[model samples]
Structures are given as structure tokens and as C-alpha cells.
Target: MDTQPNIRSYVIDLADQLGIRYQATPEDALADIATRLAGDEVVIDEIEDLLVALKRTGAINGNEMVTLLGQYLDEKFSER
Candidate 1:
């Protein structure tokens, strides 16, 4: 039995059905944000807020947004 989650297929199909074209993955998005945050201290809340703003403004699609948010939260909690 395959234990790994089969997550991406349904999302891809849903996006295709909805006619949504995604431009970047979560890692690409974090890289962009990391570039933007260069020369500054890393503040988890601030980064989260920035990502939330981007999502609110429709800058990133839902799947990538959640992925980015999950990565951010994982990093934030793991550091402690």
C-alpha cells in the first residue's frame, strides 16, 4: 500500500477545470521573498503577513500560497 499522500493530482485537475494558470511554485515564491528580505533580519510574523497580503491581492494561487505558508510555519516552529 502506498502511504504517501496523493495530493497534487486533484489540485492540478481542479485548477485545470477552473482555468487557473499558476506561474510559480512555493519554493520560487519563498526565493522571491527571500530576495526581497535580503539585508534584513528574518521576522516570521512579518514574512507571514507579507505572504498573506500577497494572497489577499491574488498575487499567488491557492495551492502555492498554502505551500508557502506551510513552509514558513514549519521553519518558524522548527527553529524553536
Candidate 2:
């Protein structure tokens, strides 16, 4: 599980790698989708692109990413 700060920081770092300026808050990052993704509103394509880059670079796998995100989300909502 990732803490709010961790998730926020990680996403920001990913954005940096993708050459995208993600100056949003952690909550914003949670809601924001792939910037380069197609579709009218969903940025899933962007996410896929990022995933590919991460995979190629051996940065992080999709499973690890999901686990961290899930942990973060659980911790966040648990507080509510």
C-alpha cells in the first residue's frame, strides 16, 4: 500500500518520465487518467503508453503499480 504522499510523488515522477507536467495534488492524480490516451475523456491510452515505458525500462510492473495504488486507496478511504 502506498501512502498519499507516496502515490502522489510516484505519479508525479511518472509524469516527469512521460514528459508531462503533473502539478496537481495527490487526489487530482488519482482522478486524472492518461494524458496521451485516446477517447473523449478517458486517458487509458496514455496509461498504456506509460506502462509500456515502465516495462521497457524495468521500472515497475503493472502488478506492483496496482498493489501500491490499492494500498493507497484503501488507506485513504479507510480514514473516512
Candidate 3:
């Protein structure tokens, strides 16, 4: 399925706020974050972007957000 661009943009834009935290390039950062992806890891920035975006948005709390994202990515990879 084609993912949403706004979500993806939100991710990278969010990553920018993370600055040093996201030391790698956007693509690399996504790849690393998405390594939960099996066998052939994907470079899907959309997913990574979402992670960063969620963190960037002050709408949520920190520990809860991490827990939520960790569960999410695990589920996504588990599906593969």
C-alpha cells in the first residue's frame, strides 16, 4: 500500500528536531530504524518518519511513545 506523504514528511521533519539523535542521513536512519524488517531490510522512510514524527509531536508522552512504537515496528516485521 502506498503510504501517506504527510506522515512521511512529518517523520523527517521530526527527525530534524532530533538532530544529533538522528545522526545518520534520513535514508540511513530509516534503514536502521526499520531493521526490524526481516531478511532484506527496507529503506522505507515512511515508517521511520512516523517514528520520528511521533517523537517530535508533543501530543504524546515519551516512555509511552517509545513503547508504542517498539510494539508497532515489531508487529510490522512480524507480519513479514
Candidate 4:
């Protein structure tokens, strides 16, 4: 069975636990979280490393990586 949706849900839940307010789109919420967590110099590599660590620790699943990280990247790039 396809588990992408489930992974995405889990990732969203994880985001909430991380204090990300879902007051807008997922991408917007991610951007807000990034700003609050990393400030202005939001390094892409550091974000990737953090996500990887989260997955390794089972805080997030492998499948949700693309869903969560990709949305953040999309939001960041759109501003460029």
C-alpha cells in the first residue's frame, strides 16, 4: 500500500510538536518555523542535516522527508 499520505501526516504532526503554527499553507508554516528556528541565514544543508537526524532518531519517517523538506525548499526558492 502507498504510505506517502501517512508519512506526510506524521510529518505535519512532528511540525506541530516543533512549534510550527499551521495558520496558513504547509509551505508558509514551514517558512515560519524555519525563520523562528534558524533566523535569517537559513542554511539548506543544515536543514537537510537536521531532517536526516530526525529521521534517524525516528522522530520522522524516511518517506516524509521529501514532502516536508521539499515544501520548505519550494517556499524558499519562490522568494528568490
User: lDDT of each structure?
Assistant: 0.58, 0.54, 0.55, 0.60
Model 4 CA deviation exceeding 4 Å by range: 1-44
Clashing pairs in 3: 11-49
For every model shown, what is its TM-score relative to the native structure? 0.42, 0.34, 0.39, 0.43
User: Which ten contiguous residues of candidate 1 have the minimum total lDDT?
Assistant: 5-14
Q: Which digits, one per residue and each the tens of the lDDT, describe model 4 over residues 16-52?
A: 5775432334674588688978767554454555565
lDDT of 3 by residue, 1-80 (tens): 75654433544555556551323457865666667664565554455545655555554468856765676566567769
Alpha-carbon RMSD, each predicted model: 9.1, 9.6, 8.6, 10.5
Ranking by lDDT: 4, 1, 3, 2
True-structure lDDT of candidate 3? 0.55
Pick the lDDT winner.
4
Regions of model 3 farther than 4 Å from truth: 1-44
- Candidate 2 TM-score to native: 0.34
lDDT of 1 by residue, 1-80 (tens): 96743334433444455555534568757876887778655544545555554565576667877996786676567769
- 2 or 4: which has the higher lDDT? 4
Pairing residues by index, what is the TM-score of model 4?
0.43
- 1-80 in candidate 2: lDDT tens per residue? 84457554565577576665323356545556443243346434334444445554557677866775566566556779
